[model samples]
Structure formats: structure tokens, C-alpha cells
Target: SPTTANLLLPRLATDRAAMAASASAPPHSLLLAAVALAALASVAAARDENGVYDPCSDTRIQRGDGFSFGIAFATLGAFYSGGSVQLSPCDRRLSLASSGQLAVFRPKVDEISLLTINTTTGFNPATAGGYMVAFAGRKYAARSVPTFVSNSSYTVSSFTLVLEFNKGRLQNLHWKKDGCGACAKSSSLVCIGKQTCAFRTQSCKSQGPVDCSIGIQLAFSGTDKHESVLNSWYEVSNLRQYSLYGLYSNLKDTLSGQFNKFF
Candidate 1:
């Protein structure tokens, strides 16, 4: 429930996995609690600052809490965005494979991160590629509202995981991971945008009930002046849990870390 401090809502946008023999936690849980407390305490004190919330919202952003199914944070210029984009059994057009589903959006060209979520668990090896959305890459359109396309990708006939970033402006912004604040992948040392970029397949093969997380930062070096800490992320396993208590705990933890990056 979005009302629960342990928000259970939207889900993915997959990339890879952990490195440390005992990988560090994504810091998602601790932060969610903090946000809850912040919203609660400040609701009366600094209510003006937290303009996004409404009088009806007794609690902060939780699962199903309006855009709660996905990400809580949006770029400086954020408008309408979010949803549980899923695919059907008959849609064989999606390149993803069998019964492939997705969740995607593009509020703007600079707004790269999509507060992505994942519902399936690593146990289901059936899940191979990831869900995806298409972006208009054309730079001129004002209020360039990026629309949601297909939902599934099993035995595809066309495209999947494709984003048409304005080729004109994106001429210089290629996928390169140069160990700056973003570069984390052991192999792809080139950072995309300001953050890091990495791709690993072996990162899956899980050990136990562990949440696998991967984030890619979109470095914006364009003329549009923007701050760092572009975005943070995590994908879920559908096989894992859709029920509130089961998935909300992990989902809150994921969003918590993402929110922390903002501060």
C-alpha cells in the first residue's frame, strides 16, 4: 500500500549487478523511513516546501501513491509520467522474448532516469532481456511528451530496449564509462552522461533471497545547465512478490537510496 512507509508500487529498467563478495546494500530502506519522518514532521512545519503532496495524502509517497508505482523523484522540469506497462501473450512483436512486459516514459530530453522498478525474482531464469520504451530524440519539440509504446517482448519481430535520444544533441553523448562519479562496471570504464555505465550478464546467478540492483547515470554535458547525481535505480522480479508486504519492503529500500542521492 502506498500508505505504508514500506511503499510497494511500480517496477524495471535492467542493466547488471554487484561486485563485492558481499555486495554493499543499496541503502534503500534507511532512506524511505527518513522520507516518511521528514514528510510527517515537516508536513506542519515546512509544508510549503513539500508542495508535491496534498491534504489527502496523510503519508508521503508510498506504493500506488499517485506516481508511487515507479519513481518518486523527477528532474528539475518534470510533468506527467509513470505506470505499470505490461505486455500480453499474443503480442509477438516485442523483441524481448516470451510474455515480456515493460514500464517506460520520457518527460523530456534531459530527464534521463525513469524511477524504474522490477517485480520478477532472479529465480525465474525465463526472464532474459528487459522491458523498454521509445523516445522521440528530436530536439525541437516543446514540452516533448514521450509516449509509452508496447508492453511485451518475447520472440520479437521488431525493436526492444531502444531509446531515440535526440541524435542532434546526443552526438557527443555516447555510451562511454570513464571512471568518474558514475563509472562502476569493472569492464565499461566509460561513463554515460555524468554517472557510470556497465553491463554484466553473470551478475544474475543469485545465491539466496537477495535483491539484485543496477543503476546507470545519464551524464548531461549539454548546453542546458544541470546538477550532478543525475539518477539512481533498481529493477524487480515479477516472480518475487506483487503483494504489499512481500515486495513493498524491498521497493521502499530501493527508492530510499535513490532519494538519498538527491541530498
Candidate 2:
């Protein structure tokens, strides 16, 4: 009864709030969106793209029969908080760099053009059967790292960075060793000192001559599933390249994109 009560209460409360809000709404567009979102909390609602009704407010996600899931940012260097989401039945995991809030997750699969605009392969949800999911960070300074199992095939075609401070800059754009030492070329990626190791034989690759003066570019690679770490820091630290420095307390931001199954 407690579990049932728990589920029913949130929906009831959400409905009440939606009704109250709608009674005094201003803009048609805003009111329409609010009503559409509230409808998702109903028990009679249909299943979402992930094949589950309601939302994944639950923290833990099961492997669900070893189904391969993935995340592609609408833009690179998007902001998210700390803690990682385990993609069970596999060594792969998704990390929210700084915040731990699930900001946006669509219930149903919808066709969109953003996926195609950025990815070279031109992924469309109508064709790919993938849905969008997103997470946001606190308001100040943070980074997002969607780390995957090294050697696991993936592509980071395009993503957007929603930085709290407009002056924020792309700090690092390279793969680093989960192990110690500067991951030299053609060397075995060690994990003795690190929490996890990179690909078996993959080494850290740098994006040479990045022009922040012009804009940020998300380097694309098809074969590497190495831990691609992207760091975001205050631009005022022009000379000092330190992760410890230039950190903030209340950084608010979000990043969204699709996790379509790649065939």
C-alpha cells in the first residue's frame, strides 16, 4: 500500500498543481506546454520511448536484458553535475559532471531535426527509434562527461554547452587515462591507479590547435569509446590551467540530446 500510495500521491499532487496553474495562466504557448507535461504523470498514460510508463524518477536503471543504450549531446561541453548513471550488463557508464538532476526526459519518441543537424550520420528518431534525455547542473560552474566503455563503438557528432557564466570556456578537449601517467602513444592503458582504464591499447589523443577565439568544436571519432573528458572553467584564468582553480559554487546549466540505438 505504501508503494501504491507513493506513486498515486505524486500524480495527484501534480494534477492539482497543473489545474491550479492552468486556472491563472497567461501565454497560450506556456500554458499548453505545462498542460502537456502534467498529462505525463497520469497512471493511464501510455509508455514512453524507453518502453516504460510515467517517468524514470527512480535513480537506479536496470540493464533491461543487456540492451545497449547511449547518449549524444545536442552540443559539446554541456553542463551536468557529479555522479554516474550505470549502464548495467556492461562496463560503460554515463557521468553527470557536476550536478545530479534529471532536467528533461521525453516520455514518447518524437521526430526531430536537431539530431540530424549535428551528426554526420544524420540520425532521425523516426528512423532511429531513439528518444531524448537531458540533465542540468547547478548555477555557477560545472562540466559534463558522458564516459563510455573504451573500445565500445560511439560517435560524438555534435553537442551544446549551456554554461552559467557566458564567459566560460572549453578548458580541455582530449581523452585522458583512467590510470596514471601521461597516456603515451602506442602504450597499454593502465588502470592500477585509476578507477577505470581506457581502451585496451588506446592512448590519449589531443585536438590540436583549438581556436577558442573562433568557437568550440567537438572532435568526432567513430571507433574510440575511451573516456573523453571535457572540462569547463572560468575564462579569467588565462594563464593558469588548473582544474582545482576557477571553480564556482552555484553553477546552473543543462544539456539535452538523443540516445538512439546505433545499427
Deviation from native of the Cα of residue 127 in model 1, angstroms: 2.9
Candidate 1 lDDT tens digits, 1-263? 02212222222212111110112111111111112211101111111121122111111221111211111121211222233332211122222322232222222222222222332222121242232222211222112222221112111111112112222222222222222332332342333334323222233224323233322222222232122221111111121122112223454456745644433
Best by lDDT: 1
Stretch of 10 with least lDDT, candidate 2 = 248-257
Per-residue CA lDDT of candidate 2, range 100-146, in tens?
21211221111110111212123222222122222212121123354
Off by over 4 Å in 1: 1-101, 107-114, 119-126, 130-173, 178-206, 219-263
Q: lDDT of candidate 1 vs native?
A: 0.23
RMSD of each: 17.1, 20.6
